[model samples]
Target chain A: MEKAIRKFWPIFVLPTLGAFAIGFLWPFVWGVYLSFCRFTTVQNVSFVGLQNYANIWIDNTFTHAFFFTAAFTVVSVALINVFAFALALLLTRKLRGTNLFRTVFFMPNLIGGIVLGYIWKTLLDGVLALLDRPLLALDATAGFWGLIILMCWQQIGYMMVIYIAGLQNVPIDLIEAARVDGATDFQTLVRIKIPMVMSNITICLFLTLTNSFKLFDQNLSLTNGLPGKDSQMLALNIYDTFYARSGPQWKGIGQAKAVIFFIVVAAIALIQLRATRSKEVQQ
Target chain B: MKAKKVVSLLTASVLALSMLAGCSAQPAADSADGAAESAPAAQEESVAQESEVAQEEAPAADGAAGQVYYLNFKPEQDEDWQNVAALYTEQTGVPVTVVTAASGQYETQLMSEMAKSEAPTLFQVNGPVGLANWRDYCYDLSGTELYSHLTNESFCLKDGEEVPAIAYVIETYGIIYNKALLEKAGYTADDITSFDTLKAVADDIQARKDELGVKGAFTSAGMDASSDWRFKTHLANLPIYYEYKEDGIGSTEAIKGTYLDNYKQIYDLYITDSTCDPSELATKTANDATAEFVNGEAVFYQNGTWEYANIEALGDENLGMLPIYIGAEGEENQGLCTGSENYWCVNKNASEEDIQATLDFLTWMITSDEGRAAMSQEMGFVTPFDTFTDEFAASNPLLQDADAYIAAGKTPVDWCFSTMPSENWKNMVGSALTAYAAGTGSWDDVVTAFVDNWATEYQLSAAAAG
Candidate 1:
């Protein structure tokens, strides 16, 4: 049976390989190539060397977006993981109505990012009107906090589900032994349960990190980098550069920015995965 | 084991075949449509020509008239364009496809569509700046009958000796006032000829809102994306226009902003005497402003003739337009902002047959009865074609008011907004305007965005163009 499977592996592998090459790999490579060229369409291109990269910093909005997105990612990742873990810990206890609570918490994850942004915008604006304060678009600080709240609301449930599964898989006998040995609840959680769930923590951290970094639809539908593009994020800034600004050169600059974006995300995600995986327990 | 192996092999082959089928289906369908059209197109070629006026230019080579694919820009006129396209296709047996881009997505849509094998044969350029991006794609109309029929020489966009594009519609925009509401406020359109009088009337009505039973003198100067264009672009045009007239130039790399103080006064009037709180205007939409005017809640709504359909609920006798007076020199003699951004350009990359077919279709649209009716009545467009006689002129009251201004010898303000460096420049100015209106920022920010940013954006665009 093993011999037969090994011999037929090519047939199974080729389909997925062909699709990956066509759908992702080919376009990605071609996109990288196009970053160095000035073109209106894919067919019409002329190579212009490092000129596109040099043009990226001519407008300070790109750098502003980078710092803004970085700050948002840091805050959102910490809040989402901490709250999600707490919810998972509480729900994993022998409590009543756990299933109902889980379903209710998870419901927001099903709504699309754009729809969620708009819903929150209207709700927040209504409250702001009642308070007679500046609306979300007029206040950059409010816009930032609004986005954080939205990110937490949408992401906490998804991360909580993952943490719940990890908690459930922790060896029940080990926890029992800790309790029998007069170990306190906090001690057991820090020493045993947290180490046991290190793998899940790694996954949740990676997901939140990348998602917060790459958020576009929510940022766009919410503030749209309003208040003079002060609240703009990296993804929205790159999009504005590509589509909002005319001229062939802007397209090339946008592509170069995208390439830089890919590198930054890849490096951060790789570092996170490596650091978290090293701490994961063998069990 | 043999049976299982046979099933696995069969499934793999099926998967590969399905992928191939998916890849090949689109072009196959596209070709089938072409094949179907070409057959009838050959037989009805002469018949199509015979129905129209005699052509002075020679017939298309080999009499192979091609199909037309027009990428329409205006979403409101989508239905009218579809009806016109259908009428032409039914009469001429030439397949005409009309694809209207959603509002604010035309440039992005045009980029992707132009990359396809079957590109749009007829498309539009907003003005000179827009033409710069797609200049290589525009076919010269210098020798066509369409060019000869143009009523105004200035309506054609020239590329040296070649006419790359022709303006199809001449629109007029100003302050559209509800005559009934104005009279109810104890004022008439004639009572507000210049900015000073306009301010007085607006302030009086605002002070007497309780007795007059109106919300405010003007509808909200909405700062939302849907309504910001009224101030950021249209109102901003006044300053640019006055500056241009003073400098004796059409467009400039760096605007001096000589009339920004006037720009501020008019903007201040709109926001202070308006229906809603200035801070809340950030959330107000175009629909809100239109509803205020339509429901008789406000006496003035700043918009254009294209809004005739939206505001027609107000009786025609109650509708009137006044020039957006910004207190420049000779302000009382200033007419409505009159010019067009809707210029039609044929795609140079399309087949020669398709180009000729597009030209013929455009000619028929301005000359034929059904076509003219659709353009004038259904679309409410004031075409720049000589064939559109007074009988086919638009019956829109706002348009008639614009004509009245022109007849009174008011010098019309050219649409200098077309020379705006980029959409990004507009957005920056819009943000500054919103910030100032909301009191989160100062008026100095607006001036900096208007004056300093204009030169920077122009320089950036010029550099990119090279």
Candidate 2:
């Protein structure tokens, strides 16, 4: 069987390899090459060495969007993970109607991002109007807080499900032994349970971090970088630069920004995976 | 030995099967390559099928030669356009497809669609500035039959001798006022012709709000995407129009902030005398503003002829158009801002057959009686064709009012705003205005966005093209 498998490896791998080359590798290579070129349509490209990257230095909006997106990711990642974990711990207990609570909590994750943004916009506006201030009046600060709340609402449940799965796998025998040895709830939670579920924490944190960084639809439908694009995120900034700005040069600049965004996200995610992996217990 | 033989035979069959599967997949990959490289071939196949039907039914039909795919811009008139396309197909035995991009997304959609192999045969540009970006894609319509159908040749956009786009519809927009509400407030149409009178009447109505049992004098000026164009594009036009007149120039390479004070005066009036507190205008939408006019809660609404259908419940007698009195010198001579951004440009890259078909279709839509009825009745369009009658204008109360202004010798403001550097520039100005209204930003920021941003974007576009 081993000999047969080894002999037929090329035949088995050829289709998938061919598909991956066509679907991803070729386009990715082409996109990188085009990032250095200036063209409106793909057919009419002209190479202009590093000019697009140079323009990004003068683009104040790109800088603003970078910092805005960074701050948002940090806040949302913290809130989403903490709340989701707490909910997971609570729901894992032998409480009545845990299934129903879990189902209800998880339902919001099913809604589309654009729909969620618009819904929260209406709700936030109504609340803000009651205080005699419109949502857009609060400027970038209000937009920041609104997006944070929205991200928490949409993501907590999804992370909670993952956390719950992690919690269920935490050896019951060890938890019992800790309790029998006169361990308090806090000790058991801190030393026994959390250490055991570090892998889940790693996954949830990675997911929330990456998702927050790449957000677009929600940012668009909610504030749309109002007050002169003050609340614009990096992804939205890249999008606006690509499609919104009129000049042909803007598209190439937008491509450079996107390449930068990709590099930042990939590096951060990789570093996080390594850091989290080291902290994770064997169990 | 016997077991080894059986195992070897099974492995041989399995290897043969795997080899067969690999061989089968090559064409599938190759075909994808073929599809990407030859979209026109695939499209031609479909066109051939369509032409087969045309030949059986109407062999002599003019539309039989080619197919038309129009990427329409207006979302409001999308259904009407689809109906028109269907009607044309029914009449000519030709296939006509109309795809309308969502509002504010036309440029983005056009860019992507133009990159596709089966690009739109017909598309639109806003004006000269829009034509500048898309000029390379536009076919010359200089000697086409459709060019002769244009009532005014000046409305057509040209790159020197090349007539790239033709304005199909002429639209007029101004401050639409409710006559009954104005009369009830003890003001006549003549009384509110200037900025002072308009302000005075608005203040009076605001002061006596309880007595009148209404909201503020106008609707909330929303700064959302749906409504921002009202201020950024249309309202901003007033200043540009006046400045152009003062400078004695039809167009400018770069605009100086000459009439910005008048621009501020009108903007202040919109916020100060409205139902919404100026602070809340950013969250308000265009629909909320229209509701104020539709429900008779506001006597005035700053919009255009296109909004007539939305507010037709007020009846034609109560509805009237007022010039946007932005406190300009000699303001009485100003009429409604009368121009168009809806110019039809046939795609230069489309097949010659398709271009000819598009030209025929456009000429027929303007010149033929049935086509004119569809344009005016279904779409409520004010066509720029000699074939159109006053009856179409009469149906639209705002257009009728605009015609009255025109007959009285008020010079209609040419849509100089269409020459705005970019949509992003307009958006920046809109945001600055919203922020200024909200007390979040100073007006100097708006001036910078308007002046500096315009120059920067203009240079960038020029640099990009060069």
Per-residue accuracy of model 2 over B1-466 as CA lDDT, tens digit each = 6786566557666665665567555321322222222333343334333433443444345538787888778768876776777678778866677766655656766776677766789999989877766778889999987787678976888778989999988899988998998888888888877899889989999888678877988888998777989999899988888888899987776888788888888899989889888877777888999998889898889999889889989998889989899999998788888999899999999998899888888888877777788888888888777777665443787888888999999989899988788888898999999888888778898888877888887776666544
Pairs with backbone N, CA or C atoms under 3 Å apart (clashes), candidate 2: none
Worst 10 residues of 1 chain B by lDDT: B28-37
For all candidates in order, the CA lDDT equals: 0.87, 0.82
What tens digits encode model 1's per-residue C-alpha lDDT throughout B315-407? 999999999998888998999999999999999999988988999999889889999999999999998899999899999999999999999
Off by over 4 Å in 1: A1-15, B1-14, B23-65
The clash number for model 1 is 0
lDDT per residue as tens, model 2, A1-283: 9986765565566556666776679878877777898877666677987888888756578899999999999999999999999999999999999999999889999998888888999888788778766464347888899999999999999999999999999998999999899999999999988999999999998999899999988898888887678899999999888777665677788888888888999999999999998989996
lDDT of 2 at B202: 91
